[model samples]
Target: MDEVLADPIDKFISLYQRDHGFNYTLEQMHGKEFGELLPEELLPSLRVYLNQKGFFRDLKVIPGAIETVEKLCEKYEVFIVSAATEFPLSLEDKQAWLADHFPFISWTNIIFCGYKIVDVDIMIDDRARNFNPKIGRHLLFTSPHNVGLTEYERVNNWAEVAEKLL
Candidate 1:
């Protein structure tokens, strides 16, 4: 759900800037996780922000995501799989966010768990580690942390996703 359909980094940036007065551009985050850009002492606080209630509720939807995914649904069984166990507090907010933004998707199609072990013919995610090359065609959704990665096919935006999948 994160970087793929929703802009969680925006949430992180908003809270980080409001609290620390340091604004970060996406370019500054290229090829690195958001925490890696912060001072070591501030790492714990970053985790705190992620754990706070409503942190995942209002993330901006990625451009073209809703329209593209809705189009894809016409041809495929769509799912909103999220790795939510890591931040227990975000489970509810993520669900609510999805409901508000992607109401066409059914609740039964959403999966919130620690491990993404679902068997699918194609998987789109920002994290390269989550891909099992032998299992399916994995499309790497471009995100700051995965910018340097080149092992898989990459889609930089939802429009690209529509062109490729729809």
Candidate 2:
């Protein structure tokens, strides 16, 4: 759920700009895979960087994420769930990242697994397929790449999410 609360693409752009001079703005990256948007030669290495050390640690918090999550936590049993099996290398890094950025969240509240199989009243995620409608209502966290996915309820930013649920 880092993508729901962290701006990884912006962090990648900064790193990519420093190493390869790929001066892309976030708006232009909307609706496209960040790696595919890069020059072909850089794609492989950049994708490798995704799970590398220090990558998740430096990601900036998505605008309004901290405040919104704090508000939600006050009113609900907030769980910071993430699909972690795909990036085995990132499990610890992601946990460290959460502790570093979200000190208010307890270790017991974090759930890491392959599929998001938890049963809950609602789930907010950037990826559309992570939640099943029969199990819970899905609130799509609008990210650049997921902006065009319109099948579910979409919240453009945390403010909208707060408006809907809080």
Candidate 3:
């Protein structure tokens, strides 16, 4: 089950940087004080533009996401836990976007709440800080934007992540 993760966003960033020669981080793209290149209202539109412009066309799923989730689903009840900004997106639009991008995922199992904590055995996310405190194991997906996070079980790719989970 895929989530509304920054992988698509990350792909956009890299493509934007490589093709347009704009070097910017996600924080800078969304930061309150420093996020001036794009207006707040345009952020979501920009993301959509990026998505449409082949930003996620050939994105490599985290190395181990498929295998790990496939394996874990056999033991624990695995589900997607995501937090999307309630900005210009109405709840419906956000849900629609998630649904369109991840048609293979089960919307019933998705939790679109602000906080990431849920009664679960394990959780994997790009943001380690948002992990559920009640979770026993925290698998951190390494993101180019999340380089400052170094305390968790950081895996550079999904394949590495699958190795750790298995």
Candidate 4:
């Protein structure tokens, strides 16, 4: 739920610009793997931000996400499935971030997995790598990174999600 529930790249870019003095827009990186698509020199340096402290702690919640998730939680089970293991420092930060913004989602429902092997009815995420046909329905939450991809059902924002799901 990193990009779906909150705008992590915004924070990442802000930090990258502040440190590296170069601005990288999210749209410029769309439809491609970041490490592979970005400049060879910049990729490794900018990637360090992912492992930094508080990278995931202070993320701005995506617009309409709180309202939509709250509404969904009332009628259906809601859980957070994050690839936290990939970035070890993110586990605590992501949990703290969720507790701060989405306290209604119990800690038990917050899962930290290396792979998106969740057995759920619906999976809402911005990353295309998380999509698996066997994992039931997949809703591609629109983000600059995944906006160009049309292979999966897309939700532009939580309003469209509320319209479609609720």
Q: For this target, which candidate reaches the highest TM-score against the unseen true structure?
A: 1
List, residue by residue over 63-104, the lDDT tens digit for candidate 1: 999999999999999888899999999999999999999999
Model 4 has an lDDT value of: 0.83
Which residue pairs come into collision in candidate 4? none
Clashing pairs in 3: 62-158, 63-157, 63-158, 63-159, 64-158, 64-159
lDDT of 2 by residue, 107-140 (tens): 9999989888887888999988787866568888
lDDT of 3 at 2: 24
Question: Stretches of candidate 3 above 4 Å error?
Answer: 1-6, 14-64, 85-105
Residue 12 local lDDT, model 2: 83
Model 1: runs farther than 4 Å from truth?
Answer: none
TM-score of 2: 0.93
Tell me the tens digit of each residue's lDDT in model 3 across 47-88: 555335333344445444555556656666667665643333
What TM-score, over all chains together, does every model reach? 0.97, 0.93, 0.59, 0.91
- Let me know the TM-score candidate 3 reaches against the reference structure: 0.59
Model 4 is weakest, by summed lDDT over 10 consecutive residues, at: 30-39
Candidate 1, position 138, lDDT: 87
**Which regions of candidate 2 fall more than 4 Å away from where they truly are?**
none
RMSD of 2: 1.4
10 residues in a row with least lDDT, candidate 1: 128-137
**Model 2 pairs in collision:** none
Off by over 4 Å in 4: 32-38
